[model samples]
Structures are given as C-alpha cells and as structure tokens.
Target chain A: MSASHPSDQDRNESLPGEAAARRVVLSVDAMGGDRGPATVVAGISRSARKNPDIDFILHGPKDELDRLIARKRGLAGRVTVRDASDVVTMHDKPSQVVRHGKSTSMWSALDAVRDGEAEVCVSCGNTGALMALSMMRLRKLPGVNRPAIAVLWPSRNPQGFNVMLDVGADIRADEKDLLQYALMGASYARNGMNLARPRIGLLNVGTEEHKGRPELKVAHELISEAAEQANFEYVGFVEGGDIPGDRCDVIVTDGFTGNVALKTGEGTASLIGDLLKEAFKYSPLSRFAAVLALTSLRRLQKRIDPRRVNGGVFLGLNGPVVKSHGSADAMGVSAAVKLAYQLAASGFQEKIAARVASAVSLAQDAAERGTETE
Target chain B: MSASHPSDQDRNESLPGEAAARRVVLSVDAMGGDRGPATVVAGISRSARKNPDIDFILHGPKDELDRLIARKRGLAGRVTVRDASDVVTMHDKPSQVVRHGKSTSMWSALDAVRDGEAEVCVSCGNTGALMALSMMRLRKLPGVNRPAIAVLWPSRNPQGFNVMLDVGADIRADEKDLLQYALMGASYARNGMNLARPRIGLLNVGTEEHKGRPELKVAHELISEAAEQANFEYVGFVEGGDIPGDRCDVIVTDGFTGNVALKTGEGTASLIGDLLKEAFKYSPLSRFAAVLALTSLRRLQKRIDPRRVNGGVFLGLNGPVVKSHGSADAMGVSAAVKLAYQLAASGFQEKIAARVASAVSLAQDAAERGTETE
Candidate 1:
C-alpha cells in the first residue's frame, strides 16, 4: 500500500524548510465530499492562509489533487498529496467499507494518522464509513467499549456552543457507555469550548430523578458518582430542550437519542430559516425590509450557521478524527480543519484517554465496593 | 365522588335550550394549568365565540369557576361548572396522582368523557399525571399494549401539521407497540388533518433498511404489512429531519425518542427566535426594518406558532384526551379547545378504536402466515 503511493514520500522529502516539519499535519480525505476535491483543496488553502503552522497530508488520486493544490498559492508547500485508487461513496456501508476499503482515499487518510504522520484526520464522507475506517485504523483507546462522535451545537451559553455526544456512533448505549460519553464529552468541552470545569447533563425525557428508562437511572447514578473524580459538575437529568440552552455545557446520551435530537434541531433550524426567507419575500415592503435588515440577519445567520460548527470529532479513539458533513462546501471544510487543528494543538486525544482510563478504574473500584457491602 | 359535585348536575340541567344538547361538549379541567381558571375560561370563551356548536363541562372548584364563567358573556349558556376539591400540581408524581387524585379537576374532567357525558376531554396539567389519570379513568382500548401521546408538529405539508406520537407516554415501546402507534397515528392524521389516506413513517436513527435498533427493523416490517389493510401508505424509515418536512403525514416512534425530538425541536425553534430578536435589536437600522416587516414577521410567527398547534392527544384509549401546554395562555388554550372540538366532531375516538382493532387482526393474520411459512 505504501509502495503504491510514491508521490506521498516524494512530496514529504521535498519540504521547503526544516521549520515546515514542525507544522501540525492533518490527514485529509479529498475524494469523498459531495463537491469533490477542488472544494477540499480550497478549504485547506483557506486554513493555510489563516494558520501559518499547519500542513495537510491530502489523500486522493495524486494527479487530480496535485492539480487542485497547485492552483492555490497559499497551499504550495503545505500539502503532501497521497495516491489512492478508490473513493468511498456516501452510500457505502460501514461494514463493507471496513472489509474492502483499503485502497479508498478515506482509508489512506486514516493511515496517515495511524502511522504517526498526522495528529488528526478529517474527512467529508459517509459518517458511518468514516467512523468505521477510523475505528479499524486508529482503534479504540484502552478500556473504551464504545467510541463516541461528539459535535458542537449552537447554544445560549456565553461560549456560543454546547458539546453533545454520541451523535450517531451506535444506537444503543448502556449505563457504562453513557458514563464514558459524559467523560469524553466533558473533555471535549474543556478543550474545544475552553470551559474550565464543564457541567455534564445526562439527556432524558424529563428532569425528574425517577423518569426515563432503567439504564438512564443507573447511568444517572454512575455519572453523578464519577463527576467528582472526573472534575466536572453533574446536572442530574436534562431534556432535549436543554441541549441548546445554557443549562449545561455538555449533554451525554446514547447515540440513538442524541442523533435524533441533533437532526431534529438541525431540521427545525433549517425550517425556521426557510420560513424567514419566505416571510421576507411575502410582500414588497417586507422584501425591502429584508434589505435594510440584511446586516442583522446576516449576523444572526453567522451566529447559528451549522457550517461554523462543521466538525463531529470521533472520541475515545487512539487518534482524533473529525467527520465533516458530506455536503460541506469550502467554508464548512475549513471550519472542520480549524477544529482538527485546535484539538491537535490542545492534545485532546491524550487528555480524553487519561479521563476514560481513570473512569474505568473508578467504576471497577465502586463495583468491588458494592459487592463487598452486599 | 359524583354525588359530592352536585353543582355539576345542576349546571348540566340549566342549559339554554334543547338545541344546545346537540353541541360538542368538551370536558375541560380549569384549575391545573399554570395560569388559573381565568385563562382557561378566557380560552373557552374565545372558542365559544369562534365556534357556535361547542359547549364545555368546566371542572374545578365550583365557586371560582362560576365567577370566571359568569364574567365571560360568550360562555354564559355554554359552560357547565363542575366542582372538584383538589388540583393536580405539576410537581405531583404520576403514581401519587393516580392513587389520590380522585378529587382533582383533571380527574373529574376525564370522568365526564369516561361516563359519556362529553365526547372528548381537554386539560392543561402535568402531562404525566394527565396520562396516568386518563389511563386509569378511560382505560386502554382492547389489544392496545401502550397508549401513546400524539402532537401536531408544524410541517411543510399542505395541511401545515404532521402527527408525531408516543411523545412521552412511556420510555419503552416494543415492535407491536410501535405498530399500534402507527395505526393510531395514521387514524389521527386522517381525522385530524382530513387526509384521505395518511402516509406513515417509522422514526429511526437512520433511513437505511439495515440501520437502527433491532426492534425498529421488526416494526418496519410490521408497519409495512399493516399499511394496506389499515388504509394508509407506509413510507418505511424516516430520520428526524423528516419530522418537520413534508415527506410523511405521520411520524411514529417510542415515547423516549419522540419526546426528546419534540423538545429538541421546540428548543431549537425558540433559540432561533431569540437570536432573530437579538439580531433586530442590535442596530437602529435593523429596528426600523423590524417595524416595516412587522406584518410579514407576524404572518411567519402565526404560521409556526406552537400555541396554534397546542394539543397533545393521548391515543389508544377508549376516549381521546387533549393535553395542552401547562403554560398556555388564553390564546393557547383556545387552540387546544379547537383541537379537542375538531377531534370530537370527526369521531376520531371511534375511528381510532376501529383502526386499532383492524390492525390487531391484521397483525394476527400476518403472524399466523409467518408461522405457516416457518
């Protein structure tokens, strides 16, 4: 596989300066986005212009990516194009991809992180396939039964975003899995949003102590007990409404509920946006009002735009991977790249690993104590 | 208990004319709402003004309700004030409410529907307590394992609202329950939205056939098999985004997921509204634009207002019960009363009962056929 991509080695060896080696290298899958590799190159170019201390291990067909990269002056010596024959499509099944996705650009991109060449991998591809390839190449951290995908949600918080997890990693999460999600989500908030001691809220139907499924009750107790050891505040139970409110900085739930809540929020925001447009276009006066209010409306749009928070970081993996939206444009991809760079700079992967490792031991000790008391 | 509330019988017999007996009588609980009986009475008065063929059996303390109803000239001959000594507070546990809530307005409200004195019941109370009391008083229909709470969501459909069920009835729903929810939801759509044959969608994490929990797959097959016999179109799996879209008329899921999605959507919509307001207030130019766009903005607001679609109907019971928002104002209460009247006029209770029975038999037949094949 390495022999097939000779251009990767050549590009790396032909770096312009020794100082360039110190730049944060992000593994990027260029072929899997809906807008194709040109948008991806443009996104990386945007990031290169903003951040002087970053490089990209661009994975795709070498000739096509090289051509795209050559057009961007800012990305000249900042990219190392890797050759891969296949592109994992949006419709590809995760199971099939894991079995036969070796030659795909997504797989090649993950290998750059797996081989210690890049601190992070970012892909605008099928989320399930990206998660699968990431798990296969990077593997789960020790003591992690399930790796979660955490995303940033626009919220009423002063930081302007709330962290929510496992937004479609797997459907089911038991008490232990939820506890792990809380740990990982809190770490993400601390690093991603700069929360000193992020407040953790367990997502449920109601805020009552005795509501929701049996697992949630157990998870509630587990999360509460671990909050002290984990160095985060535990706000017992939170409903879906609290996800966007300032009630808590991190919301933890099973992937099923979290995913549905994420999509429902997105769908509703999109609907409201569409209705707003229709309202402006309803009458001549309103249309003119839209013009006068353009600056304010644009400011509102910039505040809540989903593209501003484009990356969904896969947590509990050996190496961090950011799954950008498949339909992301250049700005969206640049947002993801910026997030990946931040996480890499903050040593988020190592911090969360330490958090989960401590949590596992804490759980084991609590279980042994429960057995002794019984 | 009925003997103690003598005012109920006296007011019932004090009707204006025999023609009033032909009107739709809604059993409305006046005390349990966040706003007192005044808001509830104002709500019924608004409804009475708009709808000539509707009357109410207003349940609460006799003296308080009589004063409130006497003030509303529109509600003079239309309201029958029932005396109930207790009020079910929002903080009351559902189990506690069921055991000791016999004297509450919410309980008395359901009794009017249970005893055939009213066609439907409407209450602005604790949803958990309302559902518990509804089940206790009206009981589940035959072959109905779990009763579901269905609400009207603003959608892209021409009808402007799509039905989503099991919003917070119970945390768990097996395949059979989900199938029954489909049946009940379809019936609600047909009667509530006046759709000839409603399209039903099963809510899941993903739209893929192989995705989601094991029970959802089983529900997918069961719902598919029953669609033709149940007189609805099965759209297979739908994700959360489709809940507000026009992809289907009915979205069915277990109570946990449905409740979370509902709250998440409401929260997101509210957040956007707040952000929009903040945007307009940011600058003097934008404030002027807001004044000019007031009518258009008002139009948009009315179209998506949650108050307009206020009722959450408890289905799969012998009688229908509308659970309005506890914080609903007079206009919100009027919207709920309107929904309750529409449901009663459409013979929605009997229609859903018949639909569920036919689905039970259809499921039985499918099971037998499956056994034969096996």
Candidate 2:
C-alpha cells in the first residue's frame, strides 16, 4: 500500500461515493494479465477501499467476474459488471486483433471510454493489441499525426518522477512529431506532477546542440520556439544519463529510442536489485546485516519498485487509457488503476488536446513563414 | 589491481619485450585527461608492470612528462615520451580540432598508429573530438561506410562483458550500416572477449521480426542471412533489457540508441550504488551491519565497477583506437591501457578489416541477387 497523508483521507471523505454524486468511473479490463482476473479483482478492491469517490466498470466474462467479485470484500456498491465473452490473448497480433476483436474485454473497455460511460480505461493485455484497439475505438486527436505512449520514470528530481513520451506508440517520429510529443509531454507533467511550467528536454546521444541526428536538430529549434506557447521551458538536448537525474521533467524522443531506453533502465535496475539481494545473503554475517538493514532496504525497495509505477498512458487519444504491465500482479494493477483515476479526475485528455492543437498551429505557421522566405 | 593468473604473466614474458621480437606498442594521448599527465603516466606504469611484452609511445610535452614518469619507478624503460607543445583541451570542438590540431598530443598519438609505429591509440579527451580525430587519422577500413565505436559492457555472460557497437561514432546507421555494425561488433567480441563464435543481436525496441522500423526489419533479414559468413551466430532483434543479459555477446545498434542505452545503464547502476550506501549508513544498527557485510559488498562493487572495463574501441578503422572516459582516474586509465594492449596484441585491426571486407562482399552479392530476382 502507498503512504497516504491524512489530508487525502479527509478529502476523500468529503466527496460522496454514490452514483448520483457523479463519481469518476474507470473502465477495467478484468482479464488478460499473467495472473488472470483474480489479480485484477484484488487490485480494484484495494483501490475501491482507499478512494471513496471512485467507481469502476469491470469488463469480462459474466460468470468468472461474478465469482471473482464475490470473493472480494469492498465491491458492494463501487462496481458495475459488464459481460464480455472474448479475451485478447498475449500472443494475438495487433492487426489480427483489429479485425476479430469486437467482443474482447480489452475492446469493450476502450468502448466504454469512447461512449462516455467511463473517463479512462485500464488494461493489462498485449501492448500492440491494446494500442490498436484504443486507436480504433477512440481515434487520434485532430492535428496529431502520431500518438505517443508516455510513462513516468523514477528520477532524482524533487517530484521523484519525470515524463518520457513515445515509449512504444510508434517506432518513428519526424521533427514535427517530436515537437508535438514535447508539447503533450509537458502538459502531462503539468497535470501529473503539478508543475506550472515543466522543463522539457529532447533526448539524444549527447546534450550538445550540434550532436545527434538531423531531425533532432530541427526538433530542438521548433520545441525551443514553441515553449512559450506550450507553457514549458525548453532545456534543449539531454542524454540518457539525465533521464534519472534532476535536470529535466519531460524527455521527448522517437518511440523506438524511448522504448529501448525505458526497458534498458528497467533491466539495469532489476539486475542491480538481484545482485544486492545476492550480496546480502552471501554469508552468515551478511545475513545478520540484512536483518539490521531490513527497514532501510525495504524503504529503498519501495521507493524504486516498478510495481508502484506500472502504467504507460496512451496520449493523443480521444480519452485517456493506461496500459498496465502484462506480468503485473495486484500491486501493479492497483498502481495502474490509481493512475487512471488520477488522469480521469484531472481531465488530462482535454488539456493534451489543447496543447497539441496550439503546437500544431505553431508548426504550420513556421512552415508557412519558411515557404514565404524561400 | 586485477586478479591475474600465473599463466598470463608467463605468456606475456614469453612474447619478449624487445623491438626485434615485435612487442605490442600503444600510443597514448597524455594531455587531455582531467588529471593530466600524472594519471596517464601512472596508468602506463601499471600496464608496463603487468605485461612485459607491451611498450608505450606517450605523446605530450616531454619536460612535464619526464618529471611525472621519473616519480613512477616501473615506467622508465617501457615508455618513450614524444614531445608535443600543443594540447587539445576538453572544450575544443571536433570541427575545430579537425582543422587545426596538427601539433596536439591527441593528434600525435593517433598519427603514431597511422604511421605503423603503434598498433593502437588510446586517449582520454573529449569523446566527439577523439572520435573525429580517430576517423580522420586512421581512416575507415575498406567497405565501411560509417565507422563504429564498440564498448565493453558488464554483463552476465561467462566473459563478464558484452560488445556494443556505434556507441557514439555516428548518429545514423541504415540497414547496410547496421549489418556492418553487426559484423564489426562480432569481430570485436571475438578478439576482445575471446569468444570464437560470438552471438550478435541487433538492438531494437522489440525482438519480434515484424516489430520496429522498416530499416530494422531489413537489417534483421540482412544480419540473419550474413551470420555464417561473418563467423558469428545471429540472435535476431534484441530489446534493451538484453544488453546486460547472457542472450548475446555483441549488441549492434546505431550510435544514437547505443549511446543512450549505455549512459542510461550507467546512470541506473550509479543510482542503485548510491542508494545502497545510503541504506548501509541509515542508523547505528545498520552501521554495524555494514561493517559485517563489508567484504561481500566490496566484492559486489568490484564486480560492477565501470573503471575495470574502461575504454571504448573505435572499430571499422585502419588501426585500433580506444577512448578512455574523460573523468577516469589512474585505475580507469590503466584499464583502458590494458584493453588497448590486449586488443593490439591480438591484432584486432586486421581481423576487423577482414570481417568488414567479407560482410561487404556478401551484401553486394545479396544486392545483385535481389536485382536478378526482380
């Protein structure tokens, strides 16, 4: 469980949880995780117990969902079950899902978000399939050429996290698309991290202005010029080493590079965690040391746990949708649900749409000015 | 100091240190390191003490170098200091260095290798400047469109390291360039890690053939087809997480992504190391625990220290060049020298040239076959 302040509980108590009170509704795909519906149900129950002004629309097979929800403790008035027959398997291809996934739980979850029944959708399914379904159901926002998936990265910043975009939405983004990602990512940081003006960085091999590919150079100029309109500060270029440091709040890059960097950072953290555990168990003296250092180690582990930050938000869509990790357990799924609730509560979709629109206009104006000069 | 075996010393002694016996000579840029000539001299002393068949051509001002080497007892006869009045400062731009750096220590070091006086050149200067100077001085090997820089990354392999290419050589690599990176990286792994048939993996966001950019798909096919001729096993596409795993020995990628992944991995490891120290110093009980676990922790630290694996080898060049980290200390510099010595002793330059030449021929053949099929 997360460490909650007393003020959060007091605010939750002040808001009524009844349907008539218009509580925020999150659509949940209650199947397709590695651990199945049981974990999803447990995660929803945990969230429902903590947040009083939230409700869920659970999508899955009626019989299986009924059985799972019956075993949970806090689902009497906070859940609405939606019967769906099909499940999107992890092995299903994205193109295949687009053609034959009409009845799948993942599709139905996104449909709820599209139909205005839920503010956001949360799913732990095949990423490609989920992304395809979300794009099909919600469609891209106007002036957005490419949609991006943004995730929160642990950093040394005072806010403890930074936003990185296009983790896996698409493999490539041109200079214009990168500028759009910066604008959208800055908006996400403003809403997610409560910063009025987020510092944005374009990810490259080196921080020097003269370094990196040609597209990055153009993107740097565009993002720098658009920062005032986008309500963000352009930090020029940043390298991968700065991703975990306190230099920038938003890192923008093509999905290919961003996804690789994200996974590489995760893998490195996991390797070190495993090695540390091995070190603590090396001998009797070390085992004794492990016991003495248990509290501090646990605190450190909790601080950097991947399960605590388990969702990648699909930006540039009609409605916000979060893709939870496929192998996530109850804790991970709960983290995703919490992210969905927060985004829905903050109305992040409208903010992102406005930001993208203004940035697109700026880009078009710059293009027209260039043509006139030529 | 490294844990060395008696056989290593025996093999080194048998090779003989005399010029007639063809001792491996390394050209070292002794001016640009943060610690200046003192650290470079100490590093050469360490290498000279360890490998009897190795000699150095140290490039710097002879007056200051003589004073530094005189304090180090083992470096007297093994090092031959070449006086160069000018030094390449870290702040110098690569373009500026290319235009007006004839008298600099870095240029002299690389010139020695180009003139066949040394087998390899090692420098601890600005990376961009060093890379530019190496490419200019050594020239590209036959059929290499864009030369690559291969680095030794700590991994779970039996050799305890993996070879990753194009770390910061060039930002863009097309399908052909990627294939060349694969070939060059495999050669580096064979000579550097002593793996006869090194497994080569193309770095991408996903491992599936259908995933990533169009160029990656073409590269996947090209590298998979050319594996046999390149004398390495192709592991197809690999994700960022695989960089530290045992799935492959060589990871081929463009300079942009490779550099980002390398720095991200370093940053994550540094963060964990810092957190571990914080945990150990939390309280009195933990302080006692730290004392008890000092030996095991020290072993773990030694196992993952970046200094032990210092130096990024510039592949696809006429002669080998290793770039040590700018902030490296004596131990780190010594590690770079040792790597340069091993690579020079193994005749990696000729081997990489041969590998690139053959791979290019196969690519040309494949192109002709494609034209015929069309």
Candidate 3:
C-alpha cells in the first residue's frame, strides 16, 4: 500500500490553476463503510459532476482508490487518493482506536482537515471511532466543553428539515454544554438551512415549564437567556413531537436522549414503509393498484427517505466533519458529500466558532447574575 | 348534577345474579379529555358490547353522562353513573389537583378503585393531574419507590406489541426503580400479552456496556441479576429502535427517555402519514390511484394506527389505571377501555405486586453483596 501511494503533487500540478484555486477540497474516507470503497468513489464522482468547484482528498488503499476514481471522468482531476494501510472495524472501541488507529483511513481523512488541506471531512465509518479520531485530530472549538453531532430531520417546516444536536457525541451534557449546543445549533440552522434567526427549542418529555429533569430546567433558563444574544428566537420548551414540527428550527438535547429519539424516529418511519409495501402486495387488486400508484408511492418514498438526509455533522470542532450512514448506498453517500460541500462552501466552521465563543461569555454573565440573586 | 345522580342500587338489582357475580367493574373518568364525555361514554359502550362480563362506574356530571350512556343499549344495565360536581381541566396543575380536586371526576373515578368498587380505573384527563390523584387515592404498592406508567408499543414481536414503562410517571428513576420497573413490566407482559417468559431490555443509547449515563450501567447490572429469579429473560441493553423491533418484549427506562421515545415515534409516523396523503393528492393520476387503492391503504392505516393501541397503564400503584389519549376519538377510547378490562380480568394488580415485592428483596441482596465486595 505504501509503494502504491499516489503523489498529490503530481495531481495538483495537472489541475488548471483557476479551477484548483476556486475548488473547495473535502476529505473522504474510502474504507470502513458497510458497502466498501466503491460506493465512496461513486459518491465523490456524483458530487464532482454536480459541483465543479468541489474536489476530494479520498483516503484508502492507494491502488484500489486510484482504479475506482479512474473510472469516473468528472472525478479525474478532482479527487486525490491518499494511501492508508489499515482500516477501522465497526467493532473497534473508540479508546482503542485512539491508541492504535494511526494508519487507518478514518484517521488519515481527519488528518487532511487538521493539516488545513481540506475544508471538511466526511466518512461512513464507525461513529464512535470517527468521533474519537476527529476530536484527537481537529480538536474542540474554544469554550466547547462537549462537542455535539447535529443532523437534519425531515420536518413540516418551510426549510423541510429541522436541526437536532448531540445525536451521539457524548451521552451527557450539563446546563452550560446544552447552552453551547443551542448556540451552535442555531449557527448550523443559519448556515446549513439558511434560516436567518432560527428558533431554538430544548427537547423534553413535555412542553410545560415545570416538567422534565432538573438539569433541563436550568438549561431552559440558560438557553432562554442566550437566545437574545445568540440571535436565535427561544421557543421555551418543546416535546418530542415538536422535533419534526414547525415549532422550531433547532432542537437541543443531551447526546443519549437525542440519539435514542433519532433512532426511534427512523425505526418508526422504516416500519411504516415496510408495512406499506406489505399492504400493496396483499392481493392482486392491490398489486394493480400499486402499479397505478407507482409514481405517488415513489413520491412519498423520496419525501421521507432516510437516504435523502445521509449526514450527521460533528459540531463544535475545529473543522467540520460529516458522518454518513454506515450502510449508505451510492446515492446516500452522494447526499452526504453534497452536505459536506455546502457546509464547506458556506464557511460554517468560522461562524459556529464565533457563536460558541460569545455563548461562553453569556453563560458566565448568567452565572454572575445567579450569584447576585442568591 | 347532584339531583341527576343515578342510583347504583337500582342498576345493580336490574342485572341477573349470575351476570353480576362475574362482571368486572371499570371506573371511567368522563371529563378533562380534549373531546369530552360523549367520547368516553361511546368508548365504554364499545367495550361493553365486545365483552359480556364487563361493567362500568362512569364518573362525570351525572346529567351529561346519563344522557350519553342511555343512547347505547349495550351500556343500559352495565353502567352506574356517579355524580361529580366539577371536572379536572387540562390546564390544572398536578399540585393543585392533588390538593383541591376531590370534587373532580378524575378524583371520583380513582376513589372507586381505592374503595374496591372497581377492578381498574380508566381516565382521559390531564396526565400529571391524573397521576397525582391516583397516587393520592390508591397509593404505591408495597416495595415500590417510584410508580411508573407503562404503555404498549406496536412492534415486530410475535405478540405485536412491546411493553415500555416509566413513559411519564416521574422524570427520575434510580437503579432500584429501574429494576422494579423491569419486574413490573415483565409481569404486565405475562398477564397482558400472555408471554410466559418475557425478555426485558434496558433502553440505552447503545447496546455496548460502557455507553449511556452512569445510572443506566448500574440498572443494567441490577436488572440482569434479578431476571432469572423473576422469571424473565434479560437481554441486556437495547436502543430506541428495539422499542418497535422484535428483539425484546419489554423496554425499561426512566420516565423522561421513554416518554420522549414514545412521542418521537408517534410524531415520525404522523409526519410520514401526512406526507403520504400529500403524495396521493399530487396529481389527477395519483388521485385515481388513491381511489383504487383505498382498501390497501386502510389496511395499512389499521396496522399502524396509534388509536389501535391507545392506552398508557400506570404501574406500581395499588390499582391499575389506564390513561387514554387526551385527544382520542371514540374508537381510540374504546381500545383503551378494552385494555383496562383485560388487565382487570387477568388480575394484573396482584401479579405485579408480588413481582415488585420479590424485586425489592433481590435489590437489597445485590446491594449487600456489593458492600461486601467493596
């Protein structure tokens, strides 16, 4: 693999000066996904064709990646293959990965962003391992105690999606960390969803002020106070139903709860979809009905398809990192690549960093006021 | 309303001796729901028509409830309307209800159970207020610390539903409480779902042992230790997806997470259904397809309809209490009534009490062993 390592300098020299200067480079891990490297190469190819200004630094076995990328004309001069001898398995522990995963493709992909060679990193590897490597390489942003992973959920909102944070970064978040999530989530909504002043809601069991855990109550006060300074409207408290509702653009919660909610929502949608298929196949009349309703069914499928929103962005980090679904197909991978490109193009990293910095000071001011009140 | 109170002695005398001896009475609160008392009366009527050995003690403004119950011939000899001067509104706080709600229908309904006049109590009132009144009237079962609310979730299991506890009883639960919930939930599954040996899974962010909050890990060990003695299989930790998956028959968690997961699942299913309707209405062809596929669509709807399983049972209390959906229609309320009748018929209260008692001793033994080990 080391002998087959391709020269990035040669690839850079081959690119036109104007195109190379205008393109935003993305770091992609080609191995460790449930589907293998072919899907990753296909994804970058789709992105390359769709956005001429997007380029990729794909990390994997150099010989394999070079052959895969060579098959796509659009990705010819747009992708740079980096050699990584080892790959992280899905079963690898995060702690073990941090200690012994230097030669893995996931590590190499994050290193591209840490070295300032790419604007963003994307991978469909083990989430725990990837987050571990991302924190080790890219580090956390200033004033961010615990980083969060923000994902887009299909919603009835005008933007067609709501941003939910801490979908499995760390399982626990205190009042201050939740406040930071609110600020960072608002920044994400603004840059990713194009909401000017996103409405932020804290996820809880009920919308009542006096409900939920004690930490959530303190977080409610902190998030409510920071909303005005953070430039996002605070929507008091929202329940789980409000996640896909039009009540708010950003929902903030601890990682454990958010992860469970995300998976539950996905599981339910998947179950309904499966039942729908079984319904359509129940009888010959229904099978004929299915043919007539093919377009409508496909339309519904596309509207709620998990593949359409394939990336969970790792937030509050030095550089942006998007984790694609582990079993993502070519199209799902493409969606993740497209999200990464958009985030990179919007310069979301700098904006989120600034928002988090101001939020830290706002938290300090609130603490001082609490002391005075006591 | 006081003048219109129906005489229970007259109704009881009208029934045949054999029928009265076998009838299991359910107390129903006919106020505080979003739709009001007409739906509640209609629900009990639906249940009464289905089960020959069921009777009801309907609590509400006697004038209104009597008028509603008289229209259903099935409920003519089975219902004894109790006079309740006031109704518990949705806006009433639990604290206020506990202190000043003696005259409310919700309070009167629970009193029937506490007084041993009814086998189970069913309410469609404000959940917080209902839980508070139930606690005040019926008290906790022996060896139970925190009472939990358990609900059935539509799942891929052979039983078609999984029991999840602490959906909204209280926000916090410790290791002992979770262990008790596991025991109580297992008993509910045995009697309610007819599972001889139910498999219980502790809900967590990940199935891995080292994930989630500190309390979950401790609960995991305690529940595992108590499973064999309690006659249920402990399947370790399960994620939110498994709530609707076939991996386990019971999901145990704190009230906060379970409530959120339940609501999130419902919300996601609802959003998809709405999107599906919009898909079928996209064009004239899709409209024609909708007409042709009505039967298939209805079958699918019946399978995933939340109304089909519309009750949340409050566990760990001296008497079983079923909380119908606040916005439930007549059909939804009827499903809840049916569940309450079945639970009463199975003597779920006594079984759960025995399980909780044994679990208490099991927990104490584990604690003593831990002290010795330390």
The TM-scores of chain A alone, one per candidate, are: 0.93, 0.93, 0.93
Comparison by DockQ, 1 against 3, better one? 1
The model with the greatest TM-score is 2
lDDT of each: 0.87, 0.84, 0.85
What's the DockQ of model 3?
0.74
- Model 3, B285-344: lDDT tens digits are 999999989999999888777788888999989999999999999998888887886787
Pick the DockQ winner: 1
Candidate 3 docking quality: incorrect, acceptable, medium or high: medium
Q: How does chain B of model 2 score on TM-score?
A: 0.94
Model 3 stretches with alpha carbons more than 4 Å out = A1-21, A370-374, B1-21, B370-374
Model 1, residue pairs in steric clash: none
Tens-digit per-residue lDDT, A94-186, candidate 3: 999999999999999999999888888999999999999899999999899999999999998987889999999999998788888998999
* Candidate 1, A152-257: lDDT as tens digits: 9989988888999999998888878888999999888877777789999999999988788877887888888898889999999999999999999899999999
Q: Assign candidate 2 its CAPRI class.
A: medium
Question: What would the per-residue lDDT of candidate 2 be over residues A244-300, giving only the tens digit for each residue?
Answer: 877898999999899989988988888777777888888888888778778878867
Residue B264 shift from truth in candidate 1, angstroms: 0.3
Candidate 2: tens digits of C-alpha lDDT, residues B41-113 = 8888887787676778899999999899899988777788889988888889999999999999999999998
Question: Of the candidates numbered 2 and 3, which has the greater TM-score value?
Answer: 2
Task: Pick out the ten consecutive residues of candidate 2 chain A with the lowest summed lDDT.
Answer: A1-10
Q: Against the true structure, whose lDDT is highest?
A: 1
Q: DockQ, per-model, please?
A: 0.78, 0.75, 0.74
